[model samples]
Target: MRRKSKCVLGIEGTAWNLSAAIVDQSRVIASAESSYHPVEGGLHPRAAAQHHATHMEQVIHDVLAKGKKNNAKISAVAFSIGPGFGPCLRTVATAARALSLSMNVPLIGVNHCIAHIEIGRWLCNVADPVILYVSGANSQVLSYRNGKYRIFGETLDIGIGNALDKFGRYAGLQHPGGPKIEEIARKAKCYMPLPYVVKGMDFSFSGLTTAAKDALAHAPLEDVCHSFQETAFAMLVEVTERALAHTGKKDILLAGGVGANSRLMEMLNTMCQDRSAKFFAPDKAYMKDNGAMIAYTGLLMLESGAVLSVEDSAVRPNYRPDEVEVTWR
Candidate 1:
């Protein structure tokens, strides 16, 4: 199949934000993200979907306007279609399908988690690497094998980011508490011993978060924060190393929201260097969740011949990463 010569408009509404982008070949021409302030506790799916319904159009318009300035004609509209809030995903998907219909272009459906891994390829140029994806709703180590992306391991319960964010909230932090915990962890010199849970290639953060909360009764919050980062990162590093060893993959790429943690990145970088392996993380923009990654992956899928019809364009809140069958052109 000949590669299509075209640009893609990617829409992402997996959770917490509404993002849209126009990607031309190797670069993102323009993109816009509208972040929502989650309620006092955390993201309420219905509330997030409501927010998307209210704000996505403006974000789409803004991104489109910016893309138009660069003479970017959207040949397709790609959307993060599953493993997300149902309402939020529906909002974005509806917009994407409508736009594709109006423009008479292909409508591509992308796996949100796979988009993160592809972003690893885009930013790091690391081919066939072990991917550690830690985000609000997902935690998994992925690799491409046997013609599809496979999950070597994943969280047994809650995602690492959500565990950390919940801990932060328990400590009276604001919405999206991972960074706040990182900040507090940076100020502590003591290290509290926290549970490190890793079973084979999989991990569990809920137990550790619970233990950390209990420890706070006698341990300084800062010390607990520091310890949480240390232990949690170690769990990730250990599983990642195991995955690499199991697969004989020397390159490791980090993606998703938690991939932005400086401490985790530093530890992984050092470990990879010591092992003579490569480690890669995208800049802040790509490191955190965004639509550009989805759009870029759409282009790759387009070139590889990955397309979906309107009928099956429904959202799966608990979509598994490896379930997606890659049909590259």
Candidate 2:
């Protein structure tokens, strides 16, 4: 008899978002997510983990219900097992283990960073491309070579999103600083001077952020936001352009929360146009941290015969994208 169709359920709780998604062979069937926003400072790992634990069950149930599937039909359970906060990663792992045991299905551990790249590739239908992964915690240029996604360039100090958030906090903006900064930057008519440091292919944002903060005392907020974004984005685009030239890749894929910024997208698009390369970025839903990417990537892993025993389902808080073996490709 022919085997039945398979569906994988993915859980994601790497940081502030608690998400669940169900995916079949072709696409994500359903996805649900709940995000925790700090009232004051940055995200607290313990508080974020507690939020995940509280909402994980409901989110999972909602996804399953939305997909119209029961536990009996699930072929595997996948969870992001690393490169995140310890408390949040552990919480998701525990939930994934329980679900795997209850359903008697295979368990898969996914690299959170790689999931972003895979989903972008899947969405754009690009075979091989230079990846610019930027988020609150990470900034790197990656390419697939020697059977793995290798990092060509990365942040030396702080990620771009974090830098923006810090600037926003200093400016008394809301929790997530990227969007607000982008909004105010639109009205900028003049640009201020800021530090632009790009060492070889790698870049540094700590110095630039400090300089931007200092400018806030004397310069208009709009000018500071504009200049800060321009300087930082120019550094990123420069590094990405260098990576493309070095790798001889004709396509560029932008993935991560920062990919949602219109100014960044415009800059990348212009650079790609000038360099005669293609640029691709997923929609907002897939660009940010979500369960759909996890579910889709997990489906690929499971199809490639990847199986994780409960004993080995422990989370890796410092998991790196290059450390994973790319069996699916």
Candidate 3:
């Protein structure tokens, strides 16, 4: 029988969601989350932070109770410390520090982007895979080399998720527009032309989204949405393909919230199949920002002797994944 490692308590509140989880090496013992939804438009930093502050207690309480019920003893207190909204990051950091002090355990400040990659690696059981991370504010093609997850390609403007949301709002769709666009695109009668800007490895989506929004004046909504998705996804796949060829890696991992898109998954899968490479993605639960990812990553970091003190546990809103040294890997 496989042995399970000690558990870690993790908290996440980077953007729209506030989540808490307890996880060990083998699986997530318990987890809970509360989401923040904007009333009229895209996510607001201050508003989202306030929502996290309001719901954090209940979320944390639920997860800890569940962890207690499972008899899981937390060895460390971990939280998403950077690459997120400043307000939200600070709120989570403060709570993490308190927990660390109360439990008399090590405090692990986890990089949010790295947490996504680690959870993807853990859930899908892939190693040394080229990664395509897509979310509301971040988009990058990365692969592990030396001691860092090197960024091979990235967006020059807004992320694909934000681009889709911008166009969605313009089309009178809801806040998180990717899923809605995907649903409507399936009913498209024909494709409409939109801007496709790929500058070597890096791609631009602001122009593409703008062009798609304008096409709504002349084309059906479904056609515009379908064309928009095709153009954007093609750009992403092109960059990912280039990364794969450059790295000479046979495995490709899709991570981040936007990886939840079925059409995007299909495009990447087709690319991997044509190239005779393997494609891996975690379950939908881990695709977005969640506490289990932070907790699992924290366990890895703690085991590797990467712990933080209260004074060093400040939040980092602009932390980059490549900035971290991959000690555990």
What would the TM-scores of all predictions be? Answer: 0.96, 0.97, 0.98
Q: Rate the local accuracy (lDDT) of all candidates.
A: 0.87, 0.91, 0.94
Tens digits of per-residue lDDT for model 3 on 171-218? 999999999999999999998768889898999999898888888888
lDDT of 2 by residue, 103-204 (tens): 899999999999999999998899999999999999999999987999999999998999999999899898799999999999998998788898988999
List where candidate 3 sits over 4 angstroms from the true fold: 1-4
Candidate ordering by lDDT (highest first): 3, 2, 1
Number of the top-ranking candidate, with lDDT as the measure: 3
Q: Residues 185-224, candidate 1, lDDT per residue (tens digit)? A: 9889788777888887889999999998898889888999
Q: Which residue pairs collide, candidate 2?
A: none
RMSD of each: 2.1, 1.7, 1.0
- List candidate 2 stretches off by more than 4 Å: 1-5, 69-72
Clashing pairs in 1: 304-328, 304-329, 305-328, 305-329
Candidate 1: stretches off by over 4 Å = 1-4
